[model samples]
Target: MKNTIYVLLLAFLTIPNLTAQDFSDIDKSPMDVTIIRNQNHSPMARVIYSRPSKNDRDIFGNLVPYGKVWRTGANEATEITIYNDMSISGQKIPAGTYSLYTIPNKTEWTIILNKNINIWGTASNYDSEKDLIRIKAPARTAAATIEDFSMAFQPIDNGANLLMGWDDTYVEIPFKNAE
Candidate 1:
């Protein structure tokens, strides 16, 4: 009985050290991201985003390939909000929150704006008819891999560019601010 107790205690003490070693090699890690729109302005929109780290892998043509549908982020589909009626990629969209998706190819990426806001990682629950807008954007390659996924809005003259990227893949969608 004493021997068994000693063995158990030894095992417990060693397990955590082993686990620490497993993660010690990683210098950086991924974290859930919070993105806010018009943070300094009134009536802003907020979104939460996250994705796995690059982990030294090539993102384009590897982790995420051409001619595939991506959830737009990690766990849940990337989300967005329109505080008021806005024009996206030349199409007008109403004010509300929506889930975003993308169909990627070599030349372009088709952005999908779905009405469903609450979902988990695509969830296989997408309804085609609920989609509010679809737009095409040119795909671009980055010189370096983005260790973690990122989404941000860059204010343009009359609109904003919704930028999404992880690793070497990136796509931008232009949306006009409500008038």
Candidate 2:
């Protein structure tokens, strides 16, 4: 009986795996810095985040579910740096680096700029007490699909329009330059 058990164990150990895992070659999301500059070509505000492709998947409500805190992008948590104090939505925010997070909904989205920085992924450890400001922004449906997640600055009179979009949906957070 002992010889039979040993023979069975030996046979099990001899089985081979048909596939190999190569972690080094796996593709990674690209890091991007989306910025807005003044007429002088100097950066006024910027967003540093990772860009994740849609890959033919639905983004809103499916990939990124509604009514939850999202990292605002892929990979590392999205970060925003302001060179000058600005008034966002209706809150006055000082010029500093902050962590950007969002809660998406069908009609509107809540945008948050927290004092927390250098963290990875969502508001897993989010402390609302550290939030500098939180405001609700209207959500819009894009006429065309955005294949990749993006944050852009559209220059206006005193400031630039902050735009976040993925798939066929988007939202805007307007900021007025404190100057």
Candidate 3:
């Protein structure tokens, strides 16, 4: 009997079981995608981000403090995937994936493209030197308040403009196809 108990305990400990738990009642942010396509109808660049709703909270000064590095979105460090080599804001960025960071201010926002892509938020492990490029984007006031954080790519001459908006604030990042 003792041997049977030991065997059963061992089997129970070694066996792997996964149980699904319902989390539908929890409030969660939804994932969003921003894609910049070429005239040929192919995606040249893309960003995978999480959209955090405002819910009447102050986004700029209170939620996201100025003079700090932000993830540019809600979660996962805001990944940027470049399908082709391009010149972004006078900087040559190679074809690869990168994490986008930004330092927001009243007048302008400094955009930082970093080599590190796997992260949670902000530049918590942010290394200034690891940044591939830094560019200044003028801050502008939107026509109306944007309840959800948003990112989109607007068409340009050869590439697209990366637009980010939240609350009543907005910024743009321009690029040109290098190929």
Clashes of each: 0, 0, 0
Off by over 4 Å in 1: 1-40, 43-45
What are the per-residue Cα lDDT tens digits for candidate 2 across 1-179? 99999999998788765475668965566888989988898878999998889999978898899999898998778999998889987578898999999999989999999898988887476767888898999999988999989889888889988999998889988989875
What lDDT would each prediction earn against the true structure?
Answer: 0.73, 0.88, 0.88
Error of 2 at 176 (Å): 0.5
Candidate 1, RMSD to the unseen true structure: 5.3
Per-prediction TM-score: 0.74, 0.82, 0.83
Model 2 misses residue 33 by how many Å? 0.7
lDDT string for model 3 (7-98, tens) is 99999888775575777876466889989778788989999988888889988877888998998877678889999899887789999999
Error of 2 at 73 (Å): 0.5
- Enumerate residue pairs that collide in model 2: none
Q: Compare the candidates by TM-score and give the number of the best one.
A: 3
Query: Between prediction 1 and prediction 2, which has the larger TM-score?
Result: 2
Query: Which ranges of candidate 2 are over 4 A from the true structure?
Result: 1-27
